[model samples]
Target: MGRRAVFDDPALRLANNLLDVGRADLHRRIVAALHDSPLEESYVGDVQDQLAAVVTDQRVAERDRREASRLIGIGDDLLAAIGRSGTVLMVWRRSPQQVDHPGQNMPLARYESDGIYQGSWGDIETFESSPELRTLAEALNWAQRRAPHVIVRPWWNDDTHYWAGDGPPPDGMDALPDHHR
Candidate 1:
């Protein structure tokens, strides 16, 4: 089995489906879909190149790579859910440069409600020093214990990024669900 960490996150259930289908079949379907896709031919060639570099098989490597792209694209709905519900506490708007290991990536979104996409915003933040973040947080709060702090920072967990929340902020920002340590 892969050594990937198993999270309690339900937002990624659809993406997890990719792992269920075997490698060969997934590649076959993905390549066919890409061929029929209305996007540019260069895009298809790029995808094919990526698969060729990573996948051992020549016939369907492009197919598998395309499948991975589909998995990630459809999975964005999960990210949007996290942002809408504020469960994605502090996160980078860009991918981290420190991908020392294979599968390392910026924090994915998670639902605080009924497992799947159904979730509530917990603590949201935009890229550092946003002009409208404060008002957004206030409007979202449902007359509870003052609004939480949406730690507005660049690169959520990057070396330059550092944010820590204590549940709901005394003034505003609250702890984000995806906040690491």
Candidate 2:
């Protein structure tokens, strides 16, 4: 009939680290100690770290309120899911590919597989066709039609040395074979 301990509170209402105890009595005693002890003062830096952790975790638990921390809304969980850590992602608002005046929306290409991405048939048929590049072009055209003014690059602003015949597509796209070559 007694209220749940702060650590066991299902809603995770407490901001402090949860207590660790192997036995119920030990757990109760620890909680009681915390309850009885004077409040501990922490440095601003330590509190900032704690606040960041709580805010990050809070953003993870809440959907709509999880933005403004990053421009792309590409939060920590999304990066960790992809094996990226300790780095920030910059998402551009506009694309430059539209400058080429290419007419079509990007047709979701595998980037490496010449496998067809038909939105209708799929990569398997596209591979069988051996006209994978053509299919990708068609997809790009399709995407252009949908988002005419859109640029198609990893990031929106910086002109990749790509089309200029200078260099590559930038990081993370190394998996994609050098189509230009």
- Alpha-carbon runs more than 4 Å astray in model 1: 1-63, 80-132, 137-181
lDDT of candidate 2 at residue 176, scale 0 to 100: 21
What RMSD does each model have against the real structure? 16.9, 19.8
Residue 53 of candidate 2: its Cα lDDT?
44
Residues 1-181 of candidate 2 have per-residue lDDT tens digits of 1112211231122322222212333233323333222112322233233334434544233421232233122222221222311111111122223434467664443333423322211122111111123333454443332221222333212333122112443453332234522
* Candidate lDDT (C-alpha), each: 0.32, 0.27
lDDT, residue 125, candidate 1: 28
Clashes of each: 13, 15
The 10 consecutive residues of candidate 1 with the worst lDDT sum are 1-10
- TM-scores of the candidates are 0.20, 0.15
| Top candidate (TM-score) | 1
Q: On residues 5-93, what C-alpha lDDT tens digit does candidate 1 reach at each position?
A: 11112212322343355444544443443332222224335444433432444543465545544444433332332232232233334
